[model samples]
Target: MSLVKAGQLDYLNELFSRYSKRIYNYFLKSTLERAESDDLTQELFIRVMKYRNSYKEGHSVQFWIFQIARNMIKDHFRKMKIHKDQFNLVEVIPEREDVGDDELFEREKKLHRAMKELSDEKRELLVLSKFQGMKYEQIAKMRDTTVSNIKVQVHRTIKELKEAYFQLEEV
Candidate 1:
């Protein structure tokens, strides 16, 4: 039992090291602030460590970690009254280079516009799948849905993104 506990701790540490950057970026995208995202990411790993004993064997670790992140995001939004804070580009916009500022700004504007058009669930799924590189099975487990549902949602989201891109091109 002691050996098992030791192994679990090692695994948890490994998981934290592997996924912290991705988790930080995910939170950064959702919150649009680097400092807040960093704090939340640290809080996430702390929670994982606190609850390590309760993690079931043979379950998907990625899903478990993502579920925790999802809950944290929901709590943050709830506490902050998300609707009151209009999507602010200044929070996430990068510094512009002299040569490509116009092109980059236009592209970022279009991407943000497209992301805003997606439903919250679709946006979250896309972030997890595309940004984090999580598999459909892991996302399904994290979201408490079936893998098939996740696949369908991803397909629809990709189609929507493509449509949005084309619309931007026409503008």
Candidate 2:
């Protein structure tokens, strides 16, 4: 980031190579839309380059990058809300050779359904803390909250998720 800020644009390639997949997956899991994830991931790096000078010195590059991603995601959801009538909620899961277990597939479907029932804030927290494997501290920092509060929120969200999952399983 510093290098990019210093006018060495070539260094952006290095940063992209390291962070793109993780950023792509983060967007994918958070949005559950492959096409949008691709666009958002591409746009995120562009923003990084465009706003390279805004990065704080000595701060975690990953954190700063994700801050941009988070804002993009929020914007995406806002747009999605405005276009909700045109958006298809149905998703066709792509079969993969690696995922041969029918049980696992069904569980994944139920999990996604359960997640959809959660509030947007709760779902984002769960995705960040659990699916994305982000630490509570980092998430707290990102949300401008305390670590303990984030932990408790994550815990309650998990409990709510479990209840939702079990209910879906029962159905």
Candidate 3:
């Protein structure tokens, strides 16, 4: 890791190469805007570099990176308050013409809307676990919470999502 401190460009590039897609997807799922997600992803890496010295050598790099990504997302929302904006939900979700299964697409859209109705904490956990494919232990470690707590939260959040989803369906 000394290579990172010595301003080794290749080391930083390697780190970015390994994690960029994960980081971008994390932000993308939250922001739902390609350009904003890209910008936040770049900023997350920059923040990672700025705080590199603080990272313990034995720690999981993925968790550390995700923790940073989580904070960056929170700060982004706090600064812009974009969630309050009025917009067409259908338009906000980008169309994927490659998804030929109409039923699957509609289900996904309903799920997304259900996800959006959840509280921020619930939504973050859902995005990290479901969209980012993070295990509960990994999420707990990153969030500095217990695995059981994370599991419970995830369970409750899923229940909440189901209720909201059905309510929307009935309308």
Best TM-score goes to which candidate? 2
Against the reference, the lDDT scores of all candidates come to 0.73, 0.85, 0.79
lDDT of 1 at 40: 95
Candidate 2: TM-score?
0.87
Greater lDDT among 1 and 2 belongs to 2
Q: Could you give the candidate ranking by lDDT, starting with the highest?
A: 2, 3, 1
Off by over 4 Å in 1: 1-14, 80-83, 86-113
- In angstroms, what RMSD does candidate 2 have relative to the true structure? 2.1
- Name the candidate, 1 or 3, with the larger lDDT value: 3
- What lDDT does model 3 reach? 0.79
Q: 1-171 in candidate 1: lDDT tens per residue?
A: 122345556666678778887788788766655676778999999898887766677776666777889999878666556554654423444556632669878777677677656665566678889867888888787778999999999999989987987787787
Clashing pairs in 3: none
> If scored against the real structure, what TM-score would every candidate get?
0.70, 0.87, 0.81
Candidate 3 residue-wise lDDT, 1-171, digit = tens: 457766675798889999998788777767555777878998988987898887777777888888888888788767546655742223234476755678878887787788778766677788899888899989888788999999999998889999999998999
Cα error, residue 94 of model 1, in Å, equals: 7.6
